[model samples]
Target: MNEHITEIVIFTALFLLVSGMGFVAARWRRADNLASLNEWGLGGRNFGSWITWFLVGGDLYTAYTFVAVPALLFGAGATGFFAVPYTVITYPLVMLVLIRLWSVSHVHGLVTPADFVRVRFGSPTLALLVAITGIVATMPYIALQLIGIEAVLKTMGVTGDLPLIIAFAILAAYTYQSGLRAPALIAFVKDILIYIVILVAVIYIPARLGGFGSIFDAADAKFAKTPAPGDGTLLNANNQLQYITLALGSAMALFLYPHSVTGVLASRSRDVIKRNMSALPAYSLLLGLIALLGYMAIAAGITPIGTDVNTVVPQLFDQMFPDWFTGVAFAAIGIGALVPAAIMSIAAANLFTRNIYKEYLRRDATDAQEARVSKLTSLVVKVGAVLCILLIDPQFSIDLQLIGGVIILQTLPSVALGLFTRWFHRVGLIAGWTAGMTAGMVLLYNIANPANNHAHFGGSAFPLSKLGFDTPMTVYAGFLALIVNLAVAALATVLARRLGSSEGVDGTSPRDYTADAGDPEVKDDLEVAGST
Candidate 1:
């Protein structure tokens, strides 16, 4: 092993500390028995504002934001910076929708968004679609986290897949033991490390490389030498559509991920959700700062160690910082992967247990049985994610996740908008989801990245002319697919209503959407429903 001893030692020490905390997290907010889905999957639905802030922030920001965003910026220029505005606008969008979701979920004892769909539309079929989409959408995402870990491991001079296997094994063990609580506790350490590392890097790197002006100038000069259209410091007219649509589509998709909603539902109350949404934008500011590392990498004249641009940040730190500090940053990135990976696996497992296993396989499953199944399923999900990275190209996995955004965005019509108005017929929502998902996948498949040998599933950018727009404009496949989805859903709803199709019973009331914690109705309803 050609590992840098100092960096590896520090990284290992910090990682061990977090692993210890992960195991102990099972007892952090001790419950009588974590046999209940509420206790294991949702952290007993009692997280306060501070814990909720870190948990949700840690869950959403992710290793992708840390590694992939900078990597994109390094490789593709301003287009990668789309993450900044997406994250900026995400808070307001979430604040508008998530408070209501929390209220409704709390009142109904809903553990997954699929459960809410099952209750709202009273259609198990529609709920099953939502559940399956979440699991499929989340799998690539979990794989992306492993990519994050792999990047750090590679930067530390650790080769082979053994280290990756060991790290994920530790992550799986803790998540299996503590479920959401493990990530909720580890999120604190992860965020703190990230903040310190990012703050120092932002301040120190720019100063070391002359200034931000030098960094931009270096990036501009580099991109100007390249023939790629959008690979520059500023956006051109042709690429502006892509930037806008990507940012908008991403904002729409952000909260739809099962893990994002899992964080919201785990909050103690609706007020906690509101407070966290407002405060979460601080991380967006951090994200914008982090994206600049791409420019900084260019300024530092750091060549990526391999074809994987995702390693830009790690390689940059390896070159720029002291050995000990590099270790700290690597730990931040590695632990960063763990937090979201744990949450995502737990979230996906919860969906399977509630929506698939219990709803279909065993309707009479007890709370303990549900928890048991969720824990094991979480292990399976993580294993699948690891295999995704081992078997597929890392860049392909990143591209898959970008398309995964499009996949999850299909849920917005059913889940997000469904939170406000039941105007969308359940049948219509199901049709819309199907249309959007299919169109998005087809479009993604047709866009080829020949240079990377990715003939199908190459990238998320599809040309507008393909849709008969008579323009050479390229737009995000997800946004266009969403348009098709909405249009189809509206037309389908009209037809369904005219044909006298049943609109199933609404199990949720308007009051349910505004209920808060400590409300007698909310508490009593959950108590009567038992653990779900």
Candidate 2:
């Protein structure tokens, strides 16, 4: 136990540092009212470029990525590298959609995508469905962050669940006190530590074990001996199509997540968001390095303790590094969990208050009431996420996360495409979301994991055979569902237009898209001006 004291001390200091920042973040900009959704949930919508960059970075790349990506490489051989290409593709995809989302969100004073969906589609039921999906999807994700900290604890042979409860209590307290700013401020430290740790691991680990070539040779030799039929190399003929579809689909769905947009929407200007999207791909380079840790684990001959892929990175660190350095690495992962978990809880809480509670339960809710509801909802979200970790197994929650992606992707037709045009009709968007959601869930439910006794997976891609094809080609369940979503929307739009159905008014303007860093019109205007 003494061997692990260094790691414990370092991580404790880091957690305290984050807590200190959480207490001070409310005063960082000194707003007159921190009791409003805009102030507490959106960080005053005043984050400049540098803070946005760090916040978004830390938000997108969680400890799940830090731990799971490497663990994937260790467990699945070449399949782990899918994260690299997916991260690479994400920025370009967001560039196509996020500018428009920012414009619409800013103009409408929207806190959640579901809020935009309700206004754009003129359907509260559809919006509520989207809201529920966002909450369900986000809950497990918050819990998954705890897995990073748990990995560190397990590595130090710290048994029992008491430590996890303590860590989450700290996270919940600060998140309640500081709101989005807590996470944004904490992100600076988390990203800095992650960059340092990954750089050191990529450099020092290979040097100690051998060069990159030697490490790969060792990994290759180990895998060659085992020779699993579907493993080795980054691609295989059997699963090539599945890989591409999953990667591309994930890239498109990445920013569709409410938490993801929550970070971007908090920015001070369109330029801040655009510039961040352009520069954010640089983090992909780091992600590639992190994923290679899986290969490093193979070379180190370290088998993960259980079926929990998230634990792989920490386990590797414990085996490879000295107790002190392991502590630093553990601190990095533990801090990594806190930043995103804070933001996710806030985002989920905002969705509940703005789209659910305020919309249906209290239409006349004031800004202070909205803030109070959201604050309480955020606490509920954290508690729910904790329950997810305690009750549901990690593997199950991970599967549910894929389901979350599919569910969020259904919002794209309403949120992303709705930004550019409204010809699709409000009712059409609703129909598309419903059909797409149903198809995606059904397909995912039918996909079986052979290794796990052919049990259906929440993360599994739909086989082409189910769609009336007999080829080896496969597609992501979300992408396929999106295709159905678009088709349904297009068809419904034509029908709605032919029947002279109400198309509803968009509350944003063309000029809104062009508004940038220093525009005065970007501020709140009472009269709504827009175009078709």
Candidate 3:
């Protein structure tokens, strides 16, 4: 501890400084009243393009990008590049739909995706399922953020749960005080540190190790000796399908996560979201550069702490950089976890407060009541995330995120598609959600990992031979589960129509999906004009 005191001092100082910024963020925009969900949970819904860019980028490209993605590459080789296509495809796909979501949300005063479902199909039951799904999916995601911070701490020789608990307490306190603004304000610092750390790592590290050529050669040589078919510097026949499907499924499920929606909905207008999505893909290039760190780790002979490859990037920095700069890189990762964890907890809390508490516990809950419940629920959500880290430590941090993807994808028919088409009957959506979640669970349960001897819930890649296929190919379980979800929903819709079941009320008009900022029809109760 004495030997590494400089790094610890720097890291702790930066972390505490950011926590201070989080507390000050409550006054950053100084909303007239901090009692409304619209003000507290969505940052007054008025952040401009630049702010939204930093907030959303900081949220999406999280510790998963900083710690897990490189760790994945360090462990599995090219298969980790799945994140590249996931980010690339995510923006264009969501650009076409998120604006519609933003428009409808603004027009109707919706706070969560489930709130939209409640209005669209006029089915509280379906909306409840969407809410539950979002909350359940986000928990492990929050846990992943914690795991990222833990990775950095472990590298710094900080062991046990005390430091983690302290980090969690600080995150919860500031997040409770500042709400969405905490993350939004702190995001500016998080992104700047990440850019510097990544940019320097990409340029300086490769040069120190000879070049990118040596990095690839080192990675190739390492993976070639591995027994796994999918472990290589390049894709092989068996895992190609897994690579493509994981990328595609991850892309589809990303924006559907409540935190991602929270980031987008906080924007001042559809135009801001449009600009952010168009430009957010630039981070994908950074992601690719970050992924290469795994190979660089291989070239530098950096090994993960114990079996957790999640520590590889942090380990690489400690091994390759000076003690002072290593602290900066580590802080980028620790704070990186903080920004997304705050947003995710808040997102899950909003889902519970608006869709569950307000809808069932108290029909007459005012904006203040909802905001109060959301803040409390956010604290509960953080506790749940902490429990997850203490108990169900997955083989890879990314698996926790992939598990979330599989569950959240079940809501596509009810949330993303329902933004445009309500062809899916409310009952059919419930049925599909049930079937999809069950199938996803069973598939995830059956996926065994020979690496760590994990017999179940090992990972998301499902081998095809289990289905009697003669080939050695495997595919992403989430993508396959989504297929089952869509199929079941379609069939259930046909069955409901033939049975003459009640067609639920549609609470929204066509204009709601296309209305822009300052449109007379769109509600002006939410102040979004000047904050830009």
TM-scores of all candidate predictions against the true structure: 0.97, 0.95, 0.97
- Which candidate, 2 or 3, has the higher TM-score? 3
Q: Candidate 3: which stretches are off by over 4 Å?
A: 392-400, 525-532
Model 1 per-residue lDDT tens digits across residues 143-181:
988888888888888889989989999999999999899
Model 1 lDDT, residue 143, Cα: 92
- What tens digits encode model 3's per-residue C-alpha lDDT throughout 1-532? 3667778999999999999999999999898888888889999888999999999999999985788788788889989989998899999988987889999988878889999999899999999999999998898888888888998898999899999999999999999999999999999999999999999999999999999998999999999898887788889889999999999889889989999999999998888989888888878999999999989999999988888888899999998899999999999989999999999999999999988998899988877888899999999999988877887755443566667889999899899889889899888888898999999988998999988787987888999899899988999998888889889999999999999999789989998999998898676654432211
The collision pairs in model 1 are none
Model 1: lDDT to the true structure: 0.89
Quote the positional error of residue 178 for candidate 2 in Å. 1.0
Count of backbone clashes for each model? 0, 2, 0
What does candidate 1 score on TM? 0.97
By lDDT, the better pick of 2 and 3 is 3
lDDT string, candidate 2, 283-344, tens digits: 89999999888888877777777666567788888878787777788888898899889999
Q: Per-candidate RMSD vs. true structure?
A: 1.5, 2.8, 2.1
Q: Please estimate how well model 2 matches the true structure, expressed as its whole-model Cα lDDT.
A: 0.80
